[model samples]
Every structure is written in C-alpha cells, then in structure tokens.
Target: MARRGKTAAKSNPSRSDCSSTSNSLSRRPSSGDVKTDLLQALSAIAAQHVNAGSIPLAAALQADLKDVLRRWKQEHASDLQKNDKYVYPLEGRYDAGESSIENVARSSRDPRIDISLEVGNLSGADEAVVRALQSICNELGFAIFLASVERARKTLDEEVLDEAVRLVRVFLLDGGRVAEHVVLSPSEILGLQHLLPRKLIIYEWAAAISALEGQGQEEVPAELSAWIELQLLELFGQVPKLYVEDGPALATVLTPRRLKDIVSVMEKFAGTTPALISFLLAIHSKEMPISEETRQAAFKAVFATMLASFDITQDPKDVRMKANEQPYRPRSLDPPPKPPRIPCLDSDSLVQLTMHVIEDDTLRHELSLFTSQLGAQTTRINPLDFESLFLPFLHSLALKTTITEPHHEDLRTLFATTITAYHDRFVGPTPPIPPSEPDVADGSRRWVRPPVRCTCAANCAPLNAFLADARRHRIEFAVGRQRRAHLHQMLDATPRTECTHRTLRGGSPEALVVTKIDWDAVHKRNVRAAWEGRLKSFGGWMEKLVGAGVDLRAVLGLEEYERVVERREEEAPEEGAKDGRAVAAAAGELRKRKASEALVRSSRLQNAEGAGRDVRRRVAETVAVVDLTDD
Candidate 1:
C-alpha cells in the first residue's frame, strides 16, 4: 500500500501541494501591476497629507513618487510610449471616468504628472508652506501655479498678493513654463492685473512680460499687444505720481528698452499726449535710462501738443493776471480748481526739456520742424510767454554743446526771426555818446559834466545850467547850509563829478563847488570792456552752434553784431588811463609784429626775383656759346 501511495504522489501531488501551488500563482504580481499599486498608494498618501494640512510631508513624498514613476517608465517603457498626458490627481483618480488603477496602468508610459492642491488661507502661511508649494510647482507644472494665483486673486489679501507675485516671478524666472504650457493669452494676464500690487508690478509682472517677449516663445496676439499698450499707458500716466511718491524707487524700475517701449506705446496711442509730456518731464533730470528715439518721440509729441494748445491772441501776461486773481470763494468751501488743460511748466523745466530735445542727435529733423513752426509764430507769441518759455529754450539750445551742424540753419532762422520780433531786448536803444572835453584857458584839464535836472523848488537853476554846459567844468551853489547840503547830495549821486564845500572869505553863505573830471572816459571804457567780454563769450558759443562756414554777423543782423561785437575794435584809448596805456602798448606791439612780417615777405620776394634774373642770364650765355661752337 505504501509503494502504491508513493507512485500516486509522484504522479499527482497531494491536495496540500496543489493548494500551495495555486496560492503562489495567485499571489505573484506582474511588474506593471506592481507599478500601478505603488503609484496608487503614493497618490493616496499625498492626498491625505494635503487634506490634513501636511503640505511639507506631501511635498517630501514627491521625490518617492517621481522615483516610482521613473522606474515604472524604465521597466514598462512601451506602455508609457504615447503622447505626453498629464496625470492630474483628483481624489486619487487620474482623470474623469478612469479609475486610479487603470490610469496608473496607462501612466507607465506617461512621465508628466501635475498635482493641483487646494490648501486654504495661504495669507499667513509659513515659509515652509511656500517652499513646499514652490517644490510641487517645480516638480509638477504651471497648472499648480495658476491655481495658486487664482486663489490669491480671489482673496485680495496683501499677504496673499505678495505670495502670488513671488510665486509667479519664480515660475517665470524658471523660463516661464506657464507660457510654454499655454499661449499666455492677454485675457489671462489682464484678469490678473488687479491682483498684482502696483509696487511689485514693475519688478514681477513687467519683468515677466519682458522675459516672455524676449524669449519669442510664441507669437503675441493682437489683443495681448493692445493690452500691453494699455497697461503701459496707464503706468506712464502714473509716472508723475509715482515719481512724487518714490522717485528713486521708480528710477530703478525702468531699463532703457523698457522706457523706450513705453514711449513707443504712447506714440501709437492718441490722446496720451498729456501723459507722455508729464512722464518725460517727471523723468527729465533723473538717471533713468532713456533711448534717443524715445526722447525724440516724447519731445515731438510735447511740441505738437503745445502748438495745438497755443492761442496767438491770448496774452500770457493777461493769463498770468487772471491766474493770480483769487478764485471766487463761496461761503462754503469749494472744490479745488481743475488743472490747466496745458501743462504749465516753469522756465527751468522748459529749459531742461529743450536741452533734452536739442542734445539728442536723432531729433535734428524734428527740431528743425518745431523751430520753423515756432519761428512763424514768433511775432504773435505773447512777449511774456516768449521770454518765459521760448527765449530760455533758445538759450538752452544755444548753450548745448552736442548740437550738430545740421541744426545750424534752423537755429539761425529762429534767431533771426526772434531778433526781428523782439528788437528792443536784443538790441536796445542807442546809448548816449559822451561829450568832448572843454578847452581850458589856464592850460588846466577839464571835463564836460552830464546834464542834471532836479524838481526841487530852489534857485539852483544856475547850477543846473552850468552843469548842462559842455564847455564849462566848474559850478558853485552859494546858499544856506540846508541848500548847500541838498546840492552836495545831488552832486554825490551824479557820476563822474566831485564836490567841495568852501566858506566864502567874509562868511558869505557856504558855497558848494562841483568839478567834473575825465571819469566819463573811464566809465565809457569800462562799459565797452564789459560789452566786449560778453561779445567774445557769445562768439565762442556761436562758433560751436553755427560752425565756421556760416557768418555769425549776418545771422545776428549786421547792425546789431557790429554794435555788440565789432564796436570794440574801433574804441579809442582814454587819456591818462592805465587800461588805455595797455591798449596802446598792445596796438604798438601788434603793428611792430605786422611790419616785421611784411619786411620778411618783401626780402624773400626780392631774393626770388634776383635768382630768376641770374637764371635767365646764365641760360642766354649758354645759348650764345652753343651758337659760336656751331659757327
């Protein structure tokens, strides 16, 4: 019986052995099934931690999840060999209608996984939470970041706003994965505009947009471009206010290209004229980087606006008077007056703006256009406004060293027109010429006194007549002490005259004697010297602006130039003056140098003539000798 049982066992195993074999077969799992099970457990654990506000723990598990996914991908590489499908976790479900197990089985070939979490109240969240959020975002994708931004936008909390800005910046700096995932549409950006804090807009939002545009990842839609334009306009509108609030901070925000972009937008959009002018004016003297093209556009816009707003008939003096008059004050307090329709820039501001316009080489053509237009209206411009605005502008342009040669003709025309319109200011009424000195009978020197007229009621008519006579140099007013004191006061105030108090021999009322010296010549020489100095200084500037080819005297009008510039050459030396002596010495030295130069030239000419004559004679003699040899 035992041998028969052994044979049977060998032929077919017992029930226990069959059960063990079946159990082993049932318990053994395939590699695909093992990967599915591991992913399911990880998803469940991550969900549990997220729900329980254990984000740090969930974030920590991301590494293990990634590892399992990687190994699964490596083992069953063919299974995950489909198009990129994001494994979005929904209650541990992969997608709608698919079980987690089925999705995990499919995910063997899908390497991309994105997790969307709803952790409430991130406003006061700890740094660890933020860090974990960042980690999840980096591992997963931009969907996570978009979800956070939406949450923060809804909350509108300051802390939430900051966190959202920080997250978006970090994501964008990571090469703008969001833009890659989607087109980064304008609607999406515009929707988030309000959520972004103004203080952080330049640093975060603008920087991100700049980066995206710079990368040229995708074509920017028209709507998106328009949206960018509108946002830039709004930001430029706030530039003045921003500068007033925090100038240095605002200065640091803009780069040259960024500023150029803003100005270009302003140029494209109409009715942004005021904002453009204000923005340029506000950033005028700052160290902010601005391109020449931008400055030209801004200045052109400003000039166009100013020309449009100009009223030739409206006198600026009258406007100023009206402005100075106090507004009607009702018994009740009134609202503030509306700002001027045109920007009322002060003289200094206008000067700075003009300088910026003139110094930019690119604006040469535009400047010519503006100056031509300005010159046409020069006569009609209110004198007060011309002096306050245009005159200073011209002065700044004149002084600017960067002005190139191309602008010279326009500047000359503008100056010529201005000089004609405002002749008195440029060339005043002719100054009075000093009278000649009188002939002295005793061979004593004398000078004619300037005429003096007083409205005092006294018998000083004699003294006045004597002072008015050019041939007489001495005058005496003999009167009471009070009258003599009055005469002394008048003579003391008068220029180029000396006064002496003399008591008559018999105590006759004290006499006030006045003698005019040759100080008038000295005074005239000093005035001429100062005028010459100014002319030389102005001539140097003209040389820079108009170049050497264009005659400055013609541009200035010959009469005015000769009076202001050339008159110094014709000045005569005053007698008994050190300045006169110096001038005479200089003239003598100049004449001597000229004479020596002429003598040297004459000597060189004579020596050349003599050598020519000698050469001719030698040649004739050689010809004669050749003829004799032939004979």
Candidate 2:
C-alpha cells in the first residue's frame, strides 16, 4: 500500500497530499480524481513560472484552458457556491521567485490580471495559488513592455542610419509615395541626428536668400517657401536633416554643372510643389558664381511650380494660408470621385473637350488637372505662341459637336494664367492649325472631321445626346475661339506699313470667317445687333421646323447653312445701324408727307382758279356768302 501511495503521488505531481498510504490501501485512486489532481498541479506550476517572468506561459495557459476550468469547477463547486475565503497563503515552502502572499492577495482584486485568483477555482486552482500565479504574470507583462522598448530602440538606430540617404532621395525624388508603409518614430529619426541638419541648413539658407532677392521683384513668392517647408516636414517628419555646421556655409561649391544639375533635379521633382523651387531659387541666387541662365532657369522652375499649383476655385482662406506660410490642412482620405464616362473618346479627345466643357463643375475639376500639366509645360514658353501651342487643340475640340454647353468665360482665365502674351519666346515644330482642317490623313491635305455617329439607335441615346450637346457646344466654342483668335491677333499684331500707313496686321485669312456671326466682334455693337436679329429669326424658324417635323440636324447639307444665312439676312435691317434707323426713318417720312400735302394744296387752288366760271355756277351762293364774310 505504501508503495502504491508513492506511485500515485509520482503520477499526480499536482497534489500536495501524496502520503495517503492508508486511503490508497482502502481504495485504489480513481483515474478521474487523479486526472483532476494532475491538472491543478500543472496550473500551479505554470502560475509560478509566470510569476518568474515567463510570458510564454500565459499563452500556453490560455489554450485548452476552458476545459481545464470546467473540470476544476466540478471539483470546487461547494467552495465557489459559498463564495468563502477559500484562498489561503501557501506555507513557507513557496518559490523564492514568487510574489509575497500579501502582494498576490492584493492583486487578486483586479479582474483582468487577477483572472486566475478571481476565477481560478473554476480552473481547478486554489484561490491562493491563482492569486500568486497572477502576480507573477503581471511582472512578466512589465518585462515584455521593457523588452519591446529596448528592441525598438536598437532597430530604430540601425534603420535610420542605414536608410538616411535613401529617405532623403525618396523624399525629393518620389515624395508622392515616400511615406507609404514605412513609419519611422521621432526617436528613430533623432538617432541619425548627426546627418540631418546640413540639408536643413541648406534649405533655410536658400530660403533666406530667395526671400531677400525675391522680395523686390515679386520673383520668389511666399508659396515656394511654404511648399518647401511642407515637403520637408512631411518627408523627414522633423527639421535639422542630419546636422549642420552652423551659419551660411554652402553644402557644396555651386559650380555651373552642379547648379545645372540641381536646377534639373528641382524641375523634375518639384511638380506642383512651389516651396522646393523657391528653395532652389534661393540656392541659385546666393551662388553668385553660377551663370545668369542657371538663375533664370531656377526662377522659371519656381514660377512654374507656383502657377501649376494655382487653382482659382480653391477657397480664399486656403490661398491666404499658403501665401502666409501656414501648413496646409491634410487632404481628406475620401476616395476620389469616379471620372465621367464618355465613350469613343481618348485622353487627347478629353483634353480637347476640356477647352469647351466649361460649365460642368466636375468636368472643370478634371480640366484643371490637364491645364495644370499644360501650365507646367508653358513655364518658360511665351504667351504669344499660345496660338501655335494651344489653338490646334482648341480647334480640334471646337470641331467636336458633341460637347454643347456654352463656353464658360472662365476658360479664358485658364488660358491667360498659363500663357503670357507679353513675349514671343517659345518656338516649337507644330504651327497653328485652322479649325476647319483639324485632321490630316495619310500625310495628305488637311481634312475635316466627319459627323460623329452612335454605335446603334436602340442602345446609345446617351451617346447621341452627348454628340448633339457636343455639336452645340462646338457652336459656342467656335464663337469663343473666333473671339480669342481675334484677341490674339490684336495682342500679337505689330505696327505694319499698310498703304504706307502704320496698321495692326490682320491674322490668318481664316480668322476673317466666322460661322456664327457672334464670333466676329471687331464691330461688336453691329455684330451683336446682327446676332440678336439672327437669334430672333432662328427662334421663329426653329419653331416652324419643329412643327413641321423637319429633321434639321439629321443630315448635314448646304440647305441648313443657306437657310440659316438667309434667315439671318432677312432678319437683319437694311440699315447697318439698328437703334438709330427708326429715328432717321421717322424724320424722313414726316418731311415727305409735308411736301406732298403742300403740293396737293397748290394743285387744288390752281385748278379752282383756272375753272372759275364752273366753280361759280356750281356754288355761286356759297361763294358770295364766303366773300361777304371775308369783307
């Protein structure tokens, strides 16, 4: 029996009471009871290991723990039901690493960390044993927190040093995606503290020089500095890029080649970021050794970045903030709206449409992006060359009849902002193409675009509608284009000897022709009058046509053109002037009527005198009475 007792004790290591020799002799230990005892013993051991700073034990305890708890609850049903103080301190044989009984008891009050203490009886654990277990797990959690901090510090130090150059390169070269995925903590950046300040100093010095030089000419706007500052803050997350050697020391000697490279890099990378350009401008200006051309290029880049970023529709407050050098509010994370669908269209077609689809706010936003890109390209280009650079595009768009909203006047603003009419500097291979001949095929003569067609009648009403709209838009666009062309001619026209007198030269021959009379506005008042008259006639004609069910736009023919011109001519007054014609006609009619009346009276009197005998015979009495009254 004593030997059996020793075997049972060995088999159930969890049980504190192993020397039950008499009880073992009385009845063999039940396998179920032994299993329960073993589980409780294992829990007690795990609880001690946790107290000794073992974090892994917590995870192990958590697995299959539910079953263990059920079994434990079954054995301690009475103690749990009674809610008695069943937990008691263990004897003086407690592990030296374990928390003191008092500490364990105190920690048992917390429901989270004291999970075993509060509910251990359900897991077949004594309350005192669970409390002791929990106290040690708390220590392990603290050790984990400390270990994480140390690991992070070591990792950060290594990463910052290793990635410092790459970070700077990525920040300047690919700022759009530089911050994705990777996040470096402030401390991590600080670890490479020795390497950050020189770049920052360079940036600051550049900014200062630009501010000083740019102030007088408005050459360097505040936006450049703001942009640079914002970009720096975003990319590096802190200033002082890798340490500086105090004062205005140049990072490197600004040799012409280096200056050129820097300018190129800035131009390529700046995009719409004005601040970067400003910083480069500052550097260029301060580096007096560089050629004037280099400085000019830097200036152009800065100007380009600023103008490309400009959005007239932006809130004034935002503009003011940028102007004042404030950080921009972070962009919202809302997904961008899906682009509008226009079938049978490509990007070039859309770009063309952008010149005409002015009223649609959504379309306007998309167009802004295109124009922004165009603006960047036009940075050094002259506005006088806008005809060569932009007219061909406008002409292509104007011929597309499917985009019918009347041209919004704001499109002019876009043109004016991007291209400068002050100089004729930019020259490219492409010359301006007339709207009438927008396309060429097989390197042959210029060709007109054919009327657009929808794929099918039943399935493409939207397409047809868009085409119709586009056509209408093209009409207004045509008018606007003509106006702008005239304006451009006026702008670019030089004093020329015409008949030996100085005169502004007329534009291309095509400029004199306008399909819509409204587009020819050199004599604006007369043209407007003609347009108003034409519109009135058109309204009446259109009503008649619609009533007659005439398909006016169904087939393109000379009849439509003839009808429109004839209607307009019939509506036009014979007099070139409208308002003054009525007054002049009324005066002339009054004079003619007066002259006719006087002549009629003279003829009647002469006839009466010549036929005096007949008159006397017919009205002798009346005539005598009239003579007596007169006497």
Candidate 3:
C-alpha cells in the first residue's frame, strides 16, 4: 500500500509545482531578462571564436547583434519612450580598440540610436573618433531639423522652425564635415528655400556640389543640376539682402572658387543666362570682393551661355527684326516646332552689361575677355551699337582720372583704339577742320556779327537773325520798356555787342538800338585765347593720364592728335604774333617808368646829403650850449 501511494505522488505533481510550471510558460521576458540573455549570447559567440580576427565569424556576429538590437528596440519601444535616461548597452564598446565607432557613426542613418551617447562619451576618444562622432551628431541633428521643416508644410509651427533653425546654425557652424554625411534632396532644398539661412545653404550646397568633383555632367542627374541652378538663382536674388545681413560672413563661405563652382553647375543646364547675369551682378556688386580670376571665369561662363542663344556674327538690325517677328503658327496636325531660343541679352542689356564690365577698373584693363567673347563676330557689331556702348564707355574713361599708373598703358591703348574706330566709322574721311579766323565784313573794320543765343519767342529771333547776317552791323528794335530791358540783357551776354535804350517823346515804346563794336577782332582774339587755354588744360590732362612726357600724338592717335594738338600748336604762334605788339608796348612803358624812377632816386640822394650837413651843424651848436650850461 505504501509503494502504490509513493508512485501516485511521483506521477502526479504537487499543486505548487504545477502552478510554477504554468507561470513560467505563460510569463513574458522582461527587458532586463532579454538584455541579460543577449549579453550572454554575445559572450558565448565571442568565446567560441579562437581566432578573434576571423572575418566571417565577426561579420556573422555583427549581423546577429544588429538583428537582435533592432528587434529589441522595436519590442521595447514602449519602455524606451518611458525612460528618457536609457543609454545604449554597446555605447562603451563602440570606441573600443576591437570596434570602430567612426565607421558606424558615418554610415548609420538610424535616428533611433541615441546620438547623445556618442556625443557625451568623448572622454577618451581619439581626435578622429571625436570628429566622426561630431559629424554624426551634426548629420542627425540636421536630419531632425529637416524633418521638422518637412512637417512644417502641413502645420506652420513657429517654435519648431525657430528651434530647427537654431539647431541648423549649430550644425553649419560646427564644420564642413556635416555636409559629407547628409545630401540634401531637391525637394528638401525647395521646402527650406525661404526658411533656411542663406549662409548655411551656401555652405552646405556648395560643399555637396563640390564633392562631385570628378563626375561628368552626364553622370550627374539632370534634375539635380537643374535644382542646383534654381537654388543658385534664388540665392542670387537675395544676394543684396543677404550680403547686408551676413556682411563679411557671406564672403567667407561663397568665396571666388565657390562662385566658380556655382557657375560651372549652372552651365550644365539650359537657359541659365538670367541667373548667371544675376550671379555676375551679385559678385560684381560693391559688397563682393571676388578675385579677378573668378570674375573672369564668371564672365566667360555668362557670356558664353548668353552668346549661345544668338548668332553674334549676324547683323544686329537683322537680329532685332527677327527677334521682333511674330511666332510661326503651326497647323493642327503639324508637330510643334522647336521653340525659338530667346537671346539672353537684348541690345540694351548687352550695352548695359558691357558698360558695367567697362566700368569695373580691374575688368576694363583685361578687356581681352570682352573681345575674346565677341570673338570673330566683332565685325558684325553695328557701328551704331558700337557708338551706343563703347563710345559712352570711352567718354567715361575721359572722366576716370583716378586710374592708377599700372592701368594707364592698357587704357591708353583702349582709348586710342576706340577714338580711331569712332573717327574712321563716324567722322569718315573728312579733313581735320583748320582753325578759322573770325569772319569779318569785307570793307568794314568790325568783325562778323555773332548770333544772339536767346531763345525767348518775343524779340530774340529777329534780333538773332539780324546779328547772324555778316553784312548787317546794326539793328533798331522799336519796343516797350520791358522789351528794351530784355534786349539790353541779351546784348550784355553777347560778346562784343552794344545796346542803348532811347525813350521817344510821343509816349512810344523805347527804341533798343543794338550795334556791333569791333565784333570780329574782339571775337577772334577771344577765340584764340580760349583755344590756347584749352590746349594747355588738355595737355596737362593727357599727361596725368599717360604720365608726363608721353606723346599726345601716340596716345590720341594721328587724326585726333593733329586735329586737337597739332592744330592748337599751329594756331599758337599766330595768336602769339597778334599779341606781340601789345606785349612790346607794355614792355616799353615799363622801361620808361624805370628810367624816371632812377632819376628820382638820384635827386633824392643829393637832397639827403644836403640835409645831413644842416643836421650836423645843429648838433655841434647844441653840444657847445650844453657844455657851457654844465660849467
């Protein structure tokens, strides 16, 4: 009976044992339990590998560890949300000699990993490791910020945007490393277009584009290049405002090389002319101190793109007519013809752009860039166009006396060439006008009457006509008091003219009697004198431009030199001869006055000696008186 009872007890479990088995089967593993199991499994795997450097085994182990970590994070997501202070279990092992945190930090895009752990665990990190971790943090922070910006599309959260901007500023200011980790999509850039700081955009986008250095345009996706160009255009529009806001900070990021990079990127896409122009103008602004090399590069890119739209060798008039012609309408069944390529620059824009290029002191010196761009097509540039554009630029050069000596020779050459071109094209084979003597009446001593310049409709025209006739010397205008006063004022302004107002006894308007007095001789003399003064002034100006002793003929060209300088020189002698008698008479008068002054001095000397004798005699008498008194 005892044996049977013991068998039953062994076969049928106790109530407590049954309850323990059911609980063990039904209960889930806690986070602590899973973590302990994961650690034990990882330890066992590590212990089994005698060769710790076995690549296959290490790879398998890493794969398993990643899978386990991923599942654990997913399963324990609720727990993770509850605990904000949870640290990654493998955080310490990341920077261990056995593992490289740099690779993981660089390759990982998982936002679930607490990046703050890597950021805070920099106590004994190597410099490279620290930079890698910092780069990772920056990338992650930027990603989060971008997410917020994306979310902002639906709901405009000012707080989120502000915080995002602050975080982005930190990432951007950290270094260029962040750019390597995160590539901004077109949509991302477009989304943050208005929101992102321009300096930050410039730095990151510029760096990203620069990273694709060796890749060909074909290798780069067209959409990306297009967006990049659009982005650049948008940025260029904000240049003035951004420059004001960022000041010198903008310059540090959008450097000359960066500008070249941007231009190169734009060149890949079609119809980049307007944006390129804006870019050119932006860099050319007083704010941006772009280097000459970069400026030229930008100019080359812009002009090349601009010129591609039209045949520069064609006549501008023809081009204008063609451009203004109505578009060709197609039949309903006809395939749509290719759209006409619109010229990037019109005549006015081209002229204005050329003026700007010419205005830049540095750029003007290197006009080979301008000429080289025009290439052989320069012959087709209309003379009218030339006059409209280069003539004004040449005239401006005359006013630009502040040009330094280093640029003088180049400018002098440009000045000479332009003047020659203008003379040959516009002035046309006409002989240089010799200096003319003032017109004089055939038998009269008085000169030809000069024209009155007054424009008043009342009495000035008749008076001017009368004065203009060389034969007529005097004219009387019977007019009112006010009319006579106006006549007198006009006569006063006119050279070598006289006017008198006479009141009639019968209450008539005063007679304004106008007459010429030595008009021709006085006018000619004054004209020659003015020419001499202008010659001297112009000679001095030329010297200032090309340095002292530079030949005016060489700088001003043969025609201009002879017309301006030689003619003045030839007329100078005649002017001197006309003044010679007046000069001689003045010298003679000076000599006569000197002789009279000498005679007066001699007479005064004699008188002084006689006075000296009388004074001596008085002194002797006084001395004798004084001696007698003292005794």
lDDT of 1 by residue, 428-487 (tens): 333333334533334333444554446465845666666656666666667788887777
* Candidate 3 wrong stretches, greater than 4 Å: 1-412, 420-543, 546-550, 556-560, 568-631
Provide the global lDDT of candidate 1 against the true structure: 0.41
Highest TM-score: which candidate?
1
Give the winner by lDDT.
1
Q: What is the lDDT of residue 336 in candidate 2?
A: 56
Each candidate's clash count: 1, 28, 1
- By summed lDDT, which 10 consecutive residues of candidate 2 come out lowest? 1-10
TM-score of each: 0.29, 0.17, 0.26
Q: Give the clashing residue pairs of candidate 1, or none.
A: 80-109
lDDT of each: 0.41, 0.31, 0.39
What tens-digit string does per-residue lDDT give for candidate 2 at 1-631? 0000000000111111111111111222324542443344444444444344332333333322323334434555545442111111222222213444553555566422321111212221223233333333233221100000101110111111111111110111101112212222222211122222233343333322323233233343464445534443333333332111111112122334445544443444443232342243334434344456655555444444544554222222221222323444557898556543221112242343343334345455545554555445455433333343343443344344322224433443333333232111222111211123212123321111222233444323322243333132212112234444543353234232010111223534222221212122325444444444433433343333323332222211223322331221122233233368785676677668756865874687577644222322322332232232221
Question: What is candidate 3's lDDT per residue for 107-145, written digit by digit as tens?
Answer: 366533323222233222122222222333333221211
- How far is 521's C-alpha from truth in model 2 (Å)? 13
Higher-scoring candidate on TM-score, 1 or 3? 1
Cα error of candidate 3 at position 307, Å: 8.8
